[model samples]
Target: MASNIPKFRFLTAAQVRRLHGTLIANAQPTQPALLESAVQSPLNIKYYNNEQNLFQLAASLPEKIMKNHAYQDGNKRTALVAADMFLKINGYKLQETPLQTGNVSQDLENAHVAVCTNAWTAEELGRFYEQSAKAIEEWTPEILAYRNEATEY
Candidate 1:
């Protein structure tokens, strides 16, 4: 039943902005309508569309946030962290993606660029997220410390 599907913790539009400030740059929004809608999309999906996979639900953050170009700049960077934060809040992390030459980060970056260019659809990115997802316990020192410190936002 759809009711049995777990409700995942979501980032607020406020949090998305906070993240944009923290990760991308410290700035105020002159026009925030699109950013707000992007951040809230997952909630709409959970309650109305009923996605069951946490990773797939998490994928919506970066997808919409980037696609909408939620910020004046660094929309790509913000979209990445926003999605990662969503996963972290709900007890997950994306595993290190593999690459042929062995530098996984490049592979992930390529995916982001492809998405930005519309070469890959949101569903493709969603699958990338789902396939890479791992429990927090499974993570090592971690991709970086951005999500480590606590904040009021």
Candidate 2:
């Protein structure tokens, strides 16, 4: 039944840009989500399908959207929100975290490990963009378990 839920499909890289534009328009300077959609890319969908590994997918997100000095603050937080939303829509019981934490880079690193196990790395994550979805049709169940058990709210 969980699988029956229609996926929240994100179509094009341009759409992600639009999402970022919306966030920037709606938020104040310090608020996260200001430039979130810019980090989006079609590669994310390809990796999610191929790896069936949310952590790798999450880790790959920042490289796609974040630019040095692009946002004054909240870029990582915005990425986290986007990743959390992505996981929830795909039937994953995601662990919750304090929104807009001060330690975003560490948290993002942790998020990557939780999803990809030892396989999570920026270098490997880079490959997802070019890979075929058929590559990971049969993944181990352990790979499905998010490493950090999500907290019950």
Candidate 3:
């Protein structure tokens, strides 16, 4: 079903490549098909194929990216960053407060492992994303920069 909500942003393959170069030391996909699959995950009908539910969108990245093995390495890192970036572009962010506990990197690591291994229920990967994603009223500056760059291409 189409959503009545306002439009949302999604990352392109080129943007993912740029992120890979900066954060993972590799800019190219080892398996181009897998990279495309991972990049297009949020649009899968099982994930609702719309902008109505942010959780569905946020939940799509780690599993596909981790399992797809798109790049030579750093798939887990890319999954985390991609999920966070997707959310930020759509007006949500992974926010942490002083009262929250546990190591975020560890949490993300555990979540990604659970996603790949199909033990997500035990690891509560949903909780990790749910706890972190907070919606805001304005577009993030990074997303604006991305919009500008996307237009230049």
Candidate 4:
């Protein structure tokens, strides 16, 4: 059965670059090859005629982007933000708090290793995404308020 949820807007390479510029100091401009892959990744997922589900798309996004090295620097950061935005637009959010623990960089590094080494299969990654995220409707007012405040700054 198809989900009742509306399809979310996936990020374009330009939007990803804009996000990187906004968030990272001295961010490197996106290369053409990088931009192409970054733009194509989600479209490929969206249009795939296979058995992949939405969770798989969401799970594959970060891994693909991070592994592609779509940016000269901060590829992992860009990947994380892009994945989060994708999930948020789709009414979900990553539950891990690597940022709160000041381990985002480390987390990304581990994610890279896992992706490259096939430590987690695509289905497994999808399960991991499911495990790490929850519906936006479940967010507490305090968490929502904090998210709002954080976005504002």
Which candidate achieves the best lDDT against the true structure? 1
lDDT of 1 by residue, 1-58 (tens): 3555565677777777877776668985545988888878787777677777777777
Per-prediction TM-score to the true structure, in the order listed: 0.77, 0.39, 0.76, 0.68
- The list of candidate 2 runs beyond 4 A from truth reads 1-8, 11-39, 42-52, 68-70, 97-120, 123-153
Candidate 4: regions farther than 4 A off: 1-6, 50-52, 95-98, 102-109, 138-153
Worst 10 residues of 1 by lDDT: 144-153
Best-to-worst order by TM-score is: 1, 3, 4, 2
In Å, residue 18's CA in model 1 sits off its true spot by 1.5
The lDDT of model 2 is 0.40
Question: Across residues 44-101, which tens digit of lDDT does each residue of candidate 2 receive?
Answer: 4544455444445544554444432134554544444445434443344233332534
Candidate 1: stretches off by over 4 Å: 1-3, 95-102, 138-153
Best candidate according to TM-score: 1
Per-residue CA lDDT of candidate 3, range 40-120, in tens?
777563345444465566667666788899888888878777776676666776633211246766666677788888877
What are the RMSDs of all candidates, in order? 5.2, 11.9, 4.9, 6.1
Q: What is the lDDT of candidate 4?
A: 0.61
State which candidate, 1 or 3, has the greater lDDT.
1
